[model samples]
Target: MRTFTVEIEKDEKFYIAQCVEHSNCFTQGKTIEEAIHNIKEVIDLILHIKRPKLHIILKDSLVNAL
Candidate 1:
C-alpha cells in the first residue's frame, strides 16, 4: 500500500480535503469526517483506475521476456 499526505481546510461552509501529492485530487464535505470519507473514496477510485494499467504493463513485460 502507498501512503499520501492529506490536507484539510475549511472554506465557507464546507471542509475541503486535498492530497498533497496530487494537486488535482480533492474533495469537499460538510464535516471533517465526511470530508475524510469522501477523500478516501476518491483515492480508491484513482487507485482502481491506475491499478489495472499497472497490471497490464507488468503482464506485457513478462510476456515480452518469455
Candidate 2:
C-alpha cells in the first residue's frame, strides 16, 4: 500500500483539497467534508491513471501490508 499527504485550504465558497505529493492533483467542494470526499476520488483517479500496474490489498493497508 502507498501513503500520501493531503492538504486542505479554504477559498471563497469552497474548500480546496490538494495532494501534497502531486501538485497537479486537486479538487474543491462546498464543505470541508465534501472536499475531503472529493479529494479522495481525485486521488483515486490519479493513482489509477498514473499507476495502472500498481497492486494493493485493500484490507491490509497498514497492519499486514506494511
Candidate 3:
C-alpha cells in the first residue's frame, strides 16, 4: 500500500481533509474522525481507479512488466 499525507483544516463547523500530493483530492466532514474516515475512503477510491491526469496505474490491475 502506498502512503499519503492527509492535512486537516477546521472551517467553522466542518473538518476538511486534503491530500498533500493531490491538490484536487479533498473532502470535509462534521468531525475530525469523520473527516479522517472520509479521506481514507476517498484516497482508496482514487488510488484504485484510473486517473485521467496522472494516468495512474490501477492498483487492482497492476502486472509484471518484466
TM-score, every prediction: 0.68, 0.67, 0.67
Q: What does candidate 2 score on TM?
A: 0.67
**Model 3 residue 63 lDDT score:** 27
The local distance difference test score of each candidate is: 0.64, 0.62, 0.63
| Model 3, runs deviating above 4 Å | 49-66
Counted clashes in each candidate structure: 0, 0, 0
Q: Ten-residue segment with the worst summed lDDT in candidate 1? A: 50-59
Residue 10 of candidate 2: its Cα lDDT? 67
Question: Model 2: residues >4 Å from true position, as ranges?
Answer: 49-66
Q: Which scores higher on lDDT, 1 or 3?
A: 1
Model 1, residue 1: C-alpha shift (Å): 1.4
Ranking by TM-score: 1, 3, 2
Alpha carbon lDDT at 18, candidate 1: 79
How big is the positional error of residue 31 in model 3, measured in Å on the Cα after superposition?
0.8
Per-residue lDDT of candidate 1, residues 1-66 (tens digit): 566677777767887877777778789889767977777778778755332111111123323545
